[model samples]
Target chain A: MAKQILSPLPGTFYRRPAPDQPVYKNEGDSVAVGDVIGLVEVMKSFNEVKSTEAGKIVKFHAENEDAVMAGQPLADLE
Target chain B: MPIKRLLIANRGEIAVRIIRAARELGIHTIQAHSTADVDSLAVKLADEAIAIGPPQAAKSYLNIPAIIDAAKKTQADAVHPGYGFLAENAEFADACAVAGLVFVGPSANAIRMMGDKVAAREAAMRAGVPTVPGSDGRVDDLETARRVIAETGFPIMIKAAAGGGGRGIRIAANPEEFDRLVPQAKAEALAAFGDGGLYLEKVIERARHIEVQILGDGHRAIHCFERECSLQRRRQKVWEEAPSISLPEAVRRKLCASAVALAEAVHYSGAGTLEYLYDDASGDFYFIEMNTRIQVEHPVTEFITGVDLVREMLKIAGGEKLRLKQSDIFMRGHAIEVRINAEDPAQNFMPAPGTVTELRVPGGNGVRFDTLLYQGYTIPPFYDSLLGKLIVWDEDRPAAIARLIRALHELQIGGVKTTRSLHLALAADPAVASAQFHTRWLEGWLESNATKLAAE
Candidate 1:
């Protein structure tokens, strides 16, 4: 079974915590529930997107710094 | 070369305002919009629309490169940044210049000069404008801050050196408070503006926030008179009125002249406002700062002076010099403007962005509703909460207040919480009715009457 982690807000999605930092969860990276996957930048503020289901990250749906709408999938976990 | 076609690098009512002004001037308009604003009123009404970038302002409205690229692609001769976003950005003006497009504002040099509050204060002082007693320049260390506070006395204003729009300000009443507030103010300033530099100024109690509207064409400038913007909520103006009723004739003239002097000193062009903190106790006014863009409350000045400021801005940008001499302009009547924000006042003024299910705008004599909202239009949640501005004009302040009350009663909106009812309550309040309120009055009034206003 696969689960999709959806963005909780509409804004620019950043894979890294900071520009210089590496991606929070990379491709094929193992993830746990309550893990910070990425950040959604909106109105100069960043909201962390966390995985709700424990699984291994299969792939990211949105590219780094890509603008994403609310409920848009951020990554796939299988 | 004149501006034959204009690219509006903004959104909402201001973009619509620019488009209409350009249309009246016989110039075509290209509205630059984000994906979220594709169906906006400005985009639909424009002669052409271009998708600049994504929904986020950083990638769209504030994306200078994309905006200039859009202007070039649309063959726009000029770009009009209608307030906020990139309006006062010196780099945007420079980019427009580099791209061979008129920026429809003051020179990049002027923007740079006024963008920094400390530098602007220096400019005002050079122009012989009275400024609030404070540190001579940016306070470099805690020692300097302490010394300035001591010299200026207690209850001082600790302000960010490179701040505007009411952010990065903290008041300190005593030595302990001053010591506690300086680092916090500096830290907040550093976070907000990337500059921890601070300045100190003596806080004038019960001061009135007044500003004068000035139009310049690089040759000379003239004042359109003054506006009383004292009624503010947390330093943000909620209501503004032109030809401040409380100002004496002498003080008013001096204030307007000082504004003109400041504008002339900068060789400022287009519509700009010079804000002042007027102390009624001493019958003196101190220059606060200059806004290098058309203000949200400009309509009140237009109503009182009968000057279409936007039209004048276009004309000035089109290589025409300002034709209105100082003697030619005259104040006609009283005018008031109330900002209608899409925020629930009772909910800590939280933004209530949503689709407008219905909008019954007020009409009749001297009533104008400047808005971009329409039925079924979904207001994106990524911008300022200002849904519209309700302005009214009449023979006097009392009449204007009466008319404004009637207009507020008639105006209707749905599907989102607004400051409409709050404005109604304020308008009906005796302090507001008598034009007797200061910048901090509204916050105090809300503290006492928020529940009552919400219940009503």
Candidate 2:
């Protein structure tokens, strides 16, 4: 079963740290606990979305700039 | 031509403000909203609402084409780009004109000129207004910079010509830091903005944030006193008042006149504000920039002067001249406005967007709350956190503070931590009551008081 990474805040999710930056993780990318998978931007402030369970990356549920809610699944890891 | 149908190209409290003024003037309203704001208070109040884009402001509120198209489709005669979003965009104003819709603000040329920091600085200089003592223009080399620094003195700001909005800024408290940071600033500026140009300006350490309200009819202008917004957090004004207690009667007159001169020089139209940094110690006021729209804190000025600023903006856009003279304006009493944002003041003001489980609005002879909140409304997380403004007026400054304290007790919002507690704490603070503070005072005050914000 694939474990899900949850967004800690309700905001717009981004795959990269910045507009010109690369995505923090890609499909099949290795993940570890405390590794930042993406960012959740709410009210103009950005909060990092970190992986809690170490596993191989499966897929991202939300695209960049997509509005997200707290506890929403952002990524899946096997 | 008088605006028959108006399209509001913004959201939140400001959009609701414009709509109320338009309705009173018997104008039809069309609200341009994003998908996320379909349930907003503005949409509910407007005659008709149209979706412009998705939730993100970049594609909706800031989307010029979508806003212009919405206006055209709704057959609106004018578009009011409330305070933020494309309010200061020169191209947006021009686009409104190109579509034959009246832009309810200044001319595009005025917006462009004031939008440029260097151009606005030069304009202020030409109008005989005081500006922060700084280098004349962008410094390309260190030799000229060093020479300029000798005249401006210590504690100067090293700003990138290509950088703005608090980016690419370095503070040099002394010559040593200046020497160390100038080269780093250049390299960073080149890497960030593709230009290594820099400028220098003296840092007024104990300055108060003062701004004058002005109304123009494209040919002449008049001042409407001033507002003191020294209490700010992260450059966002949290509390504001009219008729600054610190300014002497003579200094107030001169500061207001300079603002009028600058506005008339540019043939400004509609409502605008000229921001200044005032040093009470030296009794010097310097023009910083201009906001070419009706501001959020205009209500405090309105509470004191009895001049409806937003209504004046609508009238000016309808081709009306300045109805009141400078002599007609009078400061009646003290008024104050506090911004209520959806953030947990106890939790370092972390954004707290959630449903309003309960709402209790305060009311009285001199109390008013301009808000976009209602019970069960979920605050969308796509934009700023400003939820409303609580305004109060009284016979005197002390009385006004008393009224603020009274009204804040009556106001309530459940299910979300707000800045209400912080405001309550500030109202009871001795330093704030005495008005013994500078622009940087609140940040330092928050350091020791934040832990007690919610406990109050």
Candidate 3:
């Protein structure tokens, strides 16, 4: 079965903390459960969103500054 | 006087609307959004944007502290709550005042007075507006309810004295039904509005829901005419039209006059709508309630009167006088608006949120589409599924209908299903065409014709 991804909450997604910061993870990056992959910012507070399943990053489906709904898939892991 | 900078405290099309109006008046705009609305069209269009909170509206749009903080950070002179969420919330208004930021809506006192249905009804009666005859006030127990019913007769409606949405309403055809439905209505009312206060009203069957749009400045008020919002599904308006076709000239005059009178009596300020229920058979109208903010169907009135209601609200907050006298307001043509929601009408109006692969809005003379969407834009499912509003105006009702039909047909939105097809079918229905509709008419028609609608 494909690894399921979940949104931390409703918020905008940023691949990195700052404009010049490198992305924490990219496509094909191996990730373990509880590993931080991206940041979700709400009300000026940046939250470190962690992976719930250990897998390889299959796709970066959400763009930076993109609004994401709760439970929406932001990335695919396999 | 032009506003320097204005902060929009809500999301969706309303935020876009405020930005456009503010930009048109040469004002810098600040857009505030939840984490889930960072990429919303309004954010892209505004001069600046600040994140408020997470996707849930309670923590974001409805979070007064967060919104105030954003306003102060942006150095915004005013904040506009574009209907729903905290639009009519008195506490938010107070918070804005405390933060020294102008709230581009009614005063907190006006909202507090009108927010309670029972208080509003009483105020309307005192202002000489006709109201439904029922219990004098909230019934405390079964004994009081029985007594009130005995005085008012059967077929009464038990309504949440603090409720606005159709949520906390129960209709009892007789005493037996009343005994069972009253408790249920009270419980639902408490859950929905956080107030168990209940009032009774004589259920007016087959009533046409009409409302008058009013603009006030605390000292004087003017009415912008009326709109017939009788086309509803599950007590929510689906289609709205200005200058109701069924209302006689005398009734229309009385309705508008009464609305102005009520607003003046309250010393109301800013934009508000006075809702009424018209019994066509008896040629009588009764005050229902007052919404102390810009309404969702405001576009219909704007199309006919050419008024920028949001701009007026901002000016009113800045202590501007009534710009135009009552004589300046006159209906030019018939206008109709249909809410294009991101919901499947065939699936009991379930929300259908997804990325838009393609979007083509119909544009022509007398047609306007207010939306915050673009190609490849994903609709977040965290909020209301109302993607946009399709409005059209023409010389008459028939022309408006024709324009609406053409616009709906020409409009193309891919990636997710919408209520466009349902509106198209509703427009073609003969009963809707003839304007023989009530609040329950659309739901009843849809129930019996769901299969037919789906097949089409």
Candidate 4:
């Protein structure tokens, strides 16, 4: 079974903490219940996105720096 | 650079407005829209349309790189950022410069200078324009603020230097409140603006909100008189009228001249508005801030001055000097604009985002509706709730009010709730009709009369 990690806010989603940094988690990488998977930038403020369910990363549903709405899927976890 | 094909970097009524103005200038328009506005009226009316990103504004409207790419991709030589969103964003203007695109507005330095409230006040003061007395710069300590307060007196407003859209303001009426509010205001400013810059201003009691419209080509600017926007709800202007019926002729001239002086001092170009707080008792006005882009209430100014502000901005961007001198400008008649929002006034102004099942817009010789709505159009939930603006122009204030009332009654929108009924009631209200309302009067009136108004 796979579960999706939903974005908590409507903003631009970032895959890494900074543009120069590496990806926070690659596909097939293991994740914990409270892992920081991404960040959502709104009004020039960045908020860390934490995974609620522990599982291996399946795929990212949204592109890095893509505008996402609240409750939209960011990544799928298996 | 000649602005042959202009890209409108915005959405909603303003985008629709830009497209119309661009068409009048014989310039093709490419409307950069979000995925949510694929079927918007602006998209339908534009010469071409491009989807920059998804529904979220941060990715589409506020995304600097995406907007620049769209301008480049469409071969647009210029970009016009309408009010709100990134209209006042200095970095966005700088990015357009970096991309060799003519930004249909002022320089990035001017935007940065006037965008900050503290800096704007300082500039205004240097230009011999009176601003509300307060701290000269960001206040970091309570003792320093207290000393300033001792001179300026109490009932001061602690405002975020970079704040707009009516956010980041705290009022302290006494010493205890001042002590408690300064830190909270600083923290909120830091969170919102990414800077903890705070400044104070004396609260002018029973003040009327007046703004002067100006046009410049970075060399000389001319004022198009003033508009009174005192009728507001929750700090958002609900209705606006031009050549403020409240102002004496001498005071009006001084206010407009002061605005032009400040703009000249800053070498401001394009269309901009200088907002002021008028103390009716003292018969004096204090400069508040300057909006570096075309304002939402600009139509009321247009109705009086007969100046197509958007067209002038485009011409200025294309390297044309301002043709309309101060003597060339003339005020014709009184004009009133009522903002129709997609919110139920009875239900606490609740958001009513849905499809417009039916529509009947009012029109005549003097009534005009600036909206992005049409029959069968879906009102997206992602943006501001403004549905349209009902602008009525007549020979005088009373006649304009009568026209607005008739237009409001004739206008209808089905499927979603709107502020139409509220506007109708406001138009009929004796205080509003007589031009006796202040900036805070609408909220108080809504609290007391919204239910009755809704029932009617």
Candidate 5:
């Protein structure tokens, strides 16, 4: 079964903190529980969406600058 | 003066409605979209489109500087705030005036007067409009609250002085409940309205929520009848109808006339709604507050009156006099509106957002669907879950209800859950159909029917 990472609030999804900065995580990247995976900016505040389970990222379900809702699957991990 | 170009400073169905109206008047429209709404239907329909900022409304639609900059860059002469965001915001109206762009609503002073609940209540009292008996003003402490409760009697409602939309309120039936509820209500008021200022009011049982729509041209005003919005959940209106069935003809006239008097007292211009809580037992009504903008349920009034309220607002902002007199306004048919949200009713109204794989909207006769969705359009989950409003009009309430049922059945949206089933259930309910409900009726009905609804 794939472990899904969901958005905490409604906001724009950012694959990385800044446009030129390295992404916190990427497809095929290994991550542990509580590791930052991406950022969801809401109301000028950047919230880091952290991984709740240890896994390797299989897919990023949302694209950069895409609007995401609360509980939307942001990424798929295996 | 006709509006040469208009900028919609909000999003969703209201934006589409305004754009359609502007188009009919031969006025060009510019739509400001957040990053998430680049491909929205409103953008596609506008004469021009500009990306304001990111998805979060605070950075995009609600950001004064960004919205003003968009209007300036697009050279749009007027900004129409369609109901939400900065629609009723006084500061935004002031900013628009300073920028030399018409705000397309009430003056900033009128908005400020109605925005503050305490001040509005005081104003209503001074205007000889009946208000719910409560504390003199903002209660100072527990001692003051205790005294107020003693004087006002039990089963009183504690409310935030600056709050609206039913937020930051608590009902206490006795001393025990009052002690426990006051602190929580105060904290919520502080967090939501930025003011812990609290007031007390005797809770009116089985009160129907009715509001009168008034249009003004700075010098004079007239009433456009009343709308019954008693069917609500979480204090947010879910279904609304014109010509409330529960109110008597005399009461309705009085309520509407009182609303016009209040508007005239404030020299209110543009479109505004004076909300009231009406108790059927005593045929008594009390002023609640005023919504100083084009309301979400304006379509219902438009359906009955055949008046293009948005167009009238634009013309008024352009310094035009009232075209229609008081006697010219007449309610014809009964119109009902259901807010279709991208939410799962079975899952505690949880947001359900996804791509629209298929889309079908009802048409013909009195069926109308105002939406910004199309096939292949992804519903960005960043903002409100309101997909659109489904409104139907007919000669009577029963006919309107029948039409609504047919319309809901004909409407189809795929790849996301919606409130269609819930609305269907509510429409079929005897209480809703008979128009026998209060503000808390829907929430209670939803809770009790949750099990049966889930079984399906």
Candidate 6:
């Protein structure tokens, strides 16, 4: 079964920690629980979005710098 | 040419502020907004509204080309970059001129000059203003470093020339610490910014953040007086008061005059603020930097001076020479302003962005609530957390504080956590009441009163 990674915060989502940095996790990258998948910037404060269940990233639902809502699916895991 | 139509390239409370000022001046207002702010108060109040781009500020408010296109499409004769997004951007100022539209602030040259720390310091020195004594450029040699240290004395800061934002710096209280930290600071600077260069500056103790508000029309300039914004969190001022209570009458005259001198030297146009750090014990004030846009705390000065600063900016941009002289401006009484941000004081001021379910705005004589909040309005999560500024004025500082307290109590907003309670606690604080706080005072106060603030 496949699972979706939902953002717990409503804000702009960034795949990379910073503009100059690489994406935290690319498609096909293996993820573990507590691994920081991305960052959500809400009102100028950055909050790390970490995965809860360990799995492999199948695809990213949101692009870099996409405005997201609470519980919005950011990535899919299998 | 007088401005007939104006385009506001900003959002939130400031956009509303610009619209109000333009409306009073009989100028048609075209508010440029993001997709998230379509239903904002500013949009509804504006004579016209246009969408620039997406919700993110970079794609919207900060998008220069998009904003320029909007102005052109709307046939706006002037552009107002209300503080924050492209407010102090020299390129944006130049871009507006290139597009044959007037920018409602200083020239691009003035913004460029004051934007650089080194150039601004030099400008202050040339205008005979006292600046914080520091090493004249990089202290690359041991002899120069020793001489600079001797001049600056004990309790000095060894800062990296290329470093900023409170990084790559170390404070040495004495000679022993200086000796131990110099090499370490050099190594850190080199590792962080690829530069081993360093400088030294005198660490002013008990420094209070004082700034003079000045207006100009490219020739003459006048000051509205100084504002004290020492109460800060993470270098962001949360509360502000005009006519600094700490400055003696003589010191106040000198501080405000120096700012006017600097403004006139540059032939500055529109409203600008020159920031300074004052040490009351020594009765010494030093120029720090200049903000070339109307600041968030501007309302405090407005209350004390009875001047419409935004209106003045519009008039100046419309090719009018300054209508008022230095003698025409006078400080009436004490005024205070507290920022009401969409933040939960209980959660360490964590930003809370949601719909404003219910709203009860405070109203009375000498109390003003400049906000974008309307019933059922949702504050977007993409921008800063500042929802409004609650300003109050009275006969004196104590009276003003009392009014602030009363106003804070009467104010109410629901469905989103606000910083009103924290401001209430600050109003009641003994140090704040007596105006005995400094720039570093609020962070400590927040830590000590965290439980109490949360419980409230």
Docking class of 3: incorrect
Per-chain TM-score, chain A, candidate 6? 0.97
* Winner of 3 and 6 under TM-score: 6
- TM-score ranking from best to worst? 2, 6, 1, 5, 4, 3
Question: Candidate 1 regions off by >4 Å?
Answer: A1-78
> Clashing residue pairs, candidate 6?
none
Q: What is the DockQ of each candidate?
A: 0.27, 0.89, 0.04, 0.12, 0.20, 0.89
Per-residue lDDT of model 6, residues B1-456, tens digit only: 999999999999999999999999999999999999999999999999999999999899999999999999999999999998899888999999999999999999999887655567778999999988987666787688789877888888887765543457698988889889999999888876676878777888779999999999999999999999999898788999998999999999999999999999998999999999999889999987789999999999999989999999999999999999888899998999999999999998899999999999998989999999999998899999999999999999999999999999899898999999999999999999898888888998998999778723
Model 2 interface DockQ = 0.89
Please give the fraction of native interface contacts (Cα pairs under 8 Å between A and B) kept by each candidate: 0.24, 0.84, 0.00, 0.12, 0.24, 0.88
Query: Per-residue alpha-carbon lDDT of model 4 for B334-370, expressed as tens digits?
Result: 9999999887788877666778998999999799899
TM accuracy, model 5: 0.88
Where is model 5 more than 4 Å wrong at Cα? A1-78, B451-456
Tell me the TM-score for chain B of model 3. Answer: 0.97
Candidate 4 - CAPRI tier? incorrect
Q: Between candidates 1 and 6, which one is better according to TM-score? A: 6
Off by over 4 Å in 2: B160-169, B175-198
Better of 4 and 6 by lDDT: 6
CAPRI verdict on model 2?
high
Q: Note the Cα lDDT for every prediction shown.
A: 0.90, 0.91, 0.88, 0.90, 0.88, 0.91
lDDT of 3 by residue, B88-191 (tens): 89999999999988888888988998999999999998999999888777788888788877877878989998888565788899888888888788877777
**Rank order by DockQ, top first?**
6, 2, 1, 5, 4, 3
- State which candidate, 1 or 2, has the greater TM-score: 2
User: Looking at model 5, what is the TM-score of chain A?
Assistant: 0.94
